[model samples]
Target: MVVEEREITVGGDARPARFTSYDVEDFPVPTGREEEWRFTPLKRLKGLLKGADADGKVQIDVDGLGDGVTVTSIERDHPLVGSVLSPVERISAIAFAGFTSGTLISVAKRAVVEQPVTVTLRGEGGTAYGHLVLDVGDEASATIVLDHSGSATYAQNVEIRVGANASLTLVTVQDWARDTVHVGYHAALVGRDARFRSFTVTLGGDLVRLAPTVRYAGSGGDAELHGLVFADAGQHLEHRTLIDHETPKCRSRVAYKVALQGEGAHTVWIGDVVVRKAAEGIDTYELNRNLVLSEGARADSVPNLELETGEVEGAGHASTTGRFDDQQLFYLQSRGIPAVEARRMVVRAFFAEVIAKVPVEHLRDRLTGQIEAELEGSGV
Candidate 1:
């Protein structure tokens, strides 16, 4: 199928526009040749591209709900269900139209929640669809964790809103069983003087694709997006991110790292940032790095930046993909460290920066152990 190319005018600059709609029929089935779906494997999606009905089930459970937090179930037409997010792709649009109910988690205004909220979704089997909304009130502070496990074919949409002067940290862990296929879209809106931090950790699945986007609702907004991926033999993992700076004095930073091992292990990372003319004084930077640990593994990294006004404070992007650093490994071995132990140390250090940023101690420790386990299983 040939998809028409469209562009939108932003501050006198014409740029490619992403087609989005609430109707599933508006998006034709992807053949894997389109720019947005090029790296994804269409067959592994398990009929999601055809907008099939979600006949499976995924149990949802929440823990650590404090006094200031509330979780409720609402229908698709709820006022807050689609306020912060719109479907940007075929799978997401299908999920929006198929989900029977939506989950909404709200934090009270000016309230502080000391405990971290954890949402767990366990898939039973077959195909499933889901929608989730997280709303942080003005001046509120909270931490959230979304954990995915079990086995099934799933498509989901997550919407997040950070009110004025609020702070939110979200950590998403994708630890699905081996034979599972999943696709998710995460969209966040940052308010004036607010801060948003997101960390995505993808470890298991047959084929997983995640698209995360962020936009500024007011000036002085700040956002940071970080991701980590480990792809084993015959696994496919992909992450795509977009940051839109439409207000002045906003800032955004994106960093992602990937480790590929075993034969047929493939990973892809794409980072895109756009600065409009009204976004003067905005500072943004994006970086992506990939580490190949064995032969026959592949990694692809792409970083794009578009600036409408040259008056911005600073803007830059960088991407690098390479094998293990021989010099670093040699230096560690020269210090009397065993070859295997030295290799483990190097891999730990590579991911330490991103893992250290997690506020929860137990989660950080668990991630560390998982990475080590992956290395041991691969005989690295």
Candidate 2:
């Protein structure tokens, strides 16, 4: 059980091709090596380190950028784009010991982008890695959807930045093939008086791990995160969220729900909030709930909070993980509904709270359809 660990420098402007090649050897295990990835399956990580070449040219698609919503390629030469590139390439370099190209996108300052911009990451041929960087400028408003799906197994890293006075809605849907091994890193910096809302849906992948990190650097700002994870049969899903309040008068709230079923299906939630001394008058809280559907399934919810100031308005955290609510199930079945459908109805009702918070109508509807399909299999 060796968890491979690699020293990844903050990637500069260099793309994958320029670096001298080296084989991934004698690397330390990543399990226990990184606090953010403590609960992940490092044994299965060996697959990425087997050192295979990338499957070659990957294609990314942006769906329906209607009028008023512009799509512009982020120049690779841009200083900010190059510096803030996601760590996907570094991870892929460790697993495959090779270089890979990635993507970057940015919205103009003070621009109101009405239509939601959708980016799809599709893999082909073999194992691969992807990086996406998104920047919303000051006073701008936009909705972004990043979809990960395709024919091959791989990992992805996404970085997002919301400038001061800006508002951004981000939705991520992982609908990868059943055979894919997906790990995602989401990092964001929220500026003063800015608003950021993100929703993550996990409905695919053999093993999926998502880490979303946020830092609120401005006063009178808010950040919200919601996640829904449903796993069944030989699946492993793990989600970690970190919220940092470095400025006063900033607030953040996070809620995540997970449902698991079948043999060896495991899920873990790690929610952390840190309020610095400078972050006085802050309000922050987090909640994680997990539901188990079978005897063999397992789940864990861990919430951690650090407060450095007493001047805050309010602060707290809560976590719970359990089976379906027996009372709710019983009530449904008593209404003449079959037992399986009744159980699923309860589960769907529980998850609906988070789904309803999505601000984008199209994304909300699409996600509802997917969730319903998953519940249908549960016999609801």
Candidate 3:
């Protein structure tokens, strides 16, 4: 339960952190008493709260990158860096201030690309602050892959702008060293009639906390947020997400699946959706599911929905947290499948729907392998 609900202020004299503000000072440092920080374990965040420095210990490598996709670096003050999005939390503000430079990836307007843009980030051990922006131009379509690895304390802000009528599929894999700590905020701006799909697969890390927020710039935009988190013994992984239906007739759906195995494993999923009064006829739904694979593991699921209009076509939310389906497992075993193999089949089936949505084949195969490895009890 939240401590106090009446303490939040907006505008005028003193305003608490409004979801729309950009100023870092507008948001107070979370003391775990606030609604947003209640489920998060802030003590494990290292120093991202006080403004962690970017030590240049993170190395970025691009592979299979093609032309027409330009990568440019700009100073933090660049007008285009945060033009579409502003930090809504203290960690995001601190990250923007501490980052050495901002990376911008631009796709030409109306340009169609066949190859996927791939970027590999390896942390060389130290504290790092980062900023990444992906701007998909109007009527353009592309796939982006962001892979993170190695050891470090990393905090960053990611902003993605999906232009009018553009379609984008972005895959982010957090495969870090066990000692790594990552805290980042990802915000996406979806334009009119545009489609944006994001897949986040988190596998390896000592502690990983990711926040993804979405809002519509125009009507008829469709946004889908799909995430999968697999946590093994002693690993802490959390995902907090929000989708704001600000435009009429916009559609949005969010589904996050988590699997926890072994002792000391913890996973958290928080999903919130707000349909403003102006957003008439907006359709939205959010669902969070957790599967505990073993003893001494924990999964926390929360789904919140705020509707300000009664004219919406459809609006709802759902959450489910429990162990594996024993009946299904028994049926699989009775069909002559080995116990381990049967369990694997059920787990794969649980995740296959989301993984199949990945537009890239090689990337899908890679994610499948990681999931299989996790099911097989492989150590990170």
Top candidate, metric lDDT: 1
lDDT of 2 by residue, 157-176 (tens): 56688889999999888887
CA lDDT of every candidate: 0.90, 0.73, 0.84
TM-score-better candidate, 1 vs 2: 1
Per-residue lDDT over 1-380 for candidate 1, one digit per residue giving the tens place of the 0 to 100 score: 21333465666764655666788778878888988899988998889888777788888999999988999998987888878777878899889988998899999999899899999999898899999999999999999999999997999999999999999999999999998889999999999999999999999999999999999899999999999899999999999999988799999999998999999998999898988777899999999989999999999888989998888989999898988899999999999998889888988998999999999898999999999999989899
Give the TM-score comparing model 2 with the true structure, all chains together: 0.85
As for candidate 3, its clashing pairs are: none
Model 2, poorest ten-residue lDDT window?
13-22
Candidate 1 — which residues are off by over 4 angstroms?
Answer: 1-10
RMSD of each: 2.4, 6.5, 4.3
**Cand. 3 TM to true fold:** 0.92
For candidate 2, list the clashing residue pairs, or say none: 3-29, 3-30, 4-29, 4-30, 5-28, 192-218
For residues 164-255, could you state the per-residue lDDT of candidate 3 as single tens digits? 99998888999999988998788999999999999988988888989888989999999999998899998989998888776899999899
Task: Quote the positional error of residue 96 for candidate 1 in Å.
Answer: 0.4
> Relative to the unseen true structure, what is the C-alpha lDDT of residue 95 in candidate 1, on a scale of 0 to 100?
92
Clashes of 1: 0
In candidate 3, how many clashes are counted? Answer: 0
Best of the candidates, TM-score? 1
